[model samples]
Target: MDKRINDLKKMYMDIKIPDNIDSIIDEGVKKGEIKMKNKFKGNLIKGISSIAAVFLIFTVSINASSAFANSISDVPVIGKLVQVLQFTGNKAQGGQVTDGVDIGMISLRKAKNSEEVIIKFNKSQDNIAPCYSISYEKYPYSMIFTVSGVRKFSAEKDFEALKQSNFISDSYNIITLDDSAVRFAINFKKPVKYEVKEYKEPAQIVLSLKECEKGNDKAAYIVRTASYPQGETLGILEERLCGFENIRIVKDDKGTFAVEAGTFESEEKAKERIKEIMNKCGSDIKLYIEKREANQLPKQMQ
Candidate 1:
């Protein structure tokens, strides 16, 4: 399944899951198998939430018995188990301990120029993740990561490399929840907005962190409702422009006139305004959002 990622930090948190975790997982396994058999099926995932919905199964089964957990660990991706059996082995001595991918490495570092902090998990397989959740918290401003049905954690060698990073609090704590699960609690140097992305062939989980500004203005959205050639007369266009707030005809150097409505930093407000305009102006009027710095608007379009 594609379309980058699902919102956001916790895939399981935002998506609605069916009550039957067992059937959903079985369906995912069967679909994965079908995907394998059909080598060149062109139609792919239409929505990213579909994959997110499937992953919700893992989190629901976190407290399941050790045997059940083991079975979940073997939840097939394609034809093989989620783990690379040759490299990672189940550590359950006598009882039912779930099989999981061996954590090959945990790489923590800052982006070369930006203040972005990246945390990558190199697992034995592409779907390195099992039943996992990431939660963002305030108070001291921290993020927590937990996963279940894990086979084992690698030694502390690569984990020590995190000290080289100045992005986060530099004091992350790891707790072994049990033989089959683990938890990591980490704090940001300051408050940050985080994104989760996963890649397969080599099996990776990439967490991207961007420090939040004091006032996080995601974007300045202007809905360009209409446009006319600079020297042309307004004629019927002016009739459509009535009743809109901050309605302005901005003249750019390129000899074009833009009929824009509203300067909203809040994306939701801009979208609501767009819908109102679309409904009032009818579908014939083309409307789209243009993002720019709050101050740059006047300078670029006089």
Candidate 2:
């Protein structure tokens, strides 16, 4: 065994004589392995970067597409849309409704002229249950153009309604009372709509007689205004009060009920006649004379 070991050592020394040969070979192999590993790592990093960039692009594209879709929804239509509807005259069957008040929905209708548009209401479908009056004004800022007389409806909320009202009217056919001024009224069968935008008329009926310090004789005939809690219409009331043979109702520019009874000549005679009226009318009455026709007064009063 000693001889064999000595022989193996002599053979190894003869085969390799260079110093640090094992170290040099080991370093070269290790460097080659490291370079290959580095190359593989570099390829992995590039692949990862490419994947990340694609994923980011896809995410941004998705978000941008979604935003564009949202913006398009807010634009207004370029043209008008028409809807054909059937009018059975069966008033609106359901929805929020109030008592004694008529609710009507509106739609626009263009005339043959096209420029002229009308807010047409569906009257055929409108019905009144138990008979009632319906007064409606266009919503927002429109005046009521149509007022239906008292009619009967089978259902409570029955009124076929359509409209094309656009412009707003500050004045309409409704009469509005101003302040506490005493006003005598006679509703004619065909009563004209009076627009008294302002209250400029002096109080025709002086509630306080003390305001008129002058003796009653000073003023010939006095114009009086009175109202009844219940009774006949305005024309009927005027006929009863003004015993004139012919009576005509004319609408003053101010929109007041003027009973132009036959012009009187004698203020004293008119005053005497007023006394009779006071006795008959009981209490609430107002008196006035034709301010323009003072010449019609009695010779002394004039």
* Among all candidates shown, the one with the greatest TM-score: 1
Encode model 2's per-residue lDDT on 102-170: one tens digit a residue. 212222222222211122112223222111122211111111221232122222121121223122112
Kindly report which residue stretches of model 1 are placed more than 4 angstroms away from their true locations once superposed: 1-98, 112-128, 215-302
| Strongest candidate by lDDT | 1
Which pairs of residues have clashing backbones in candidate 1? Answer: 126-203
Poorest 10 consecutive residues by lDDT, candidate 1: 87-96
lDDT of 1 by residue, 205-275 (tens): 45566756753334477766445663334324544766886554453225355666767776788889989
Cα-based lDDT for every prediction: 0.52, 0.32
Backbone collisions counted per model: 1, 23
Error of 1 at 162 (Å): 1.6
- TM-score per candidate: 0.35, 0.21
Model 1, residue 44: C-alpha shift (Å)? 43
Query: Candidate 2: how many backbone clashes?
Result: 23
The positional error of residue 125 in candidate 1, measured at the CA in angstroms, is 5.7
Alpha-carbon deviation at 216 in model 2, angstroms: 30
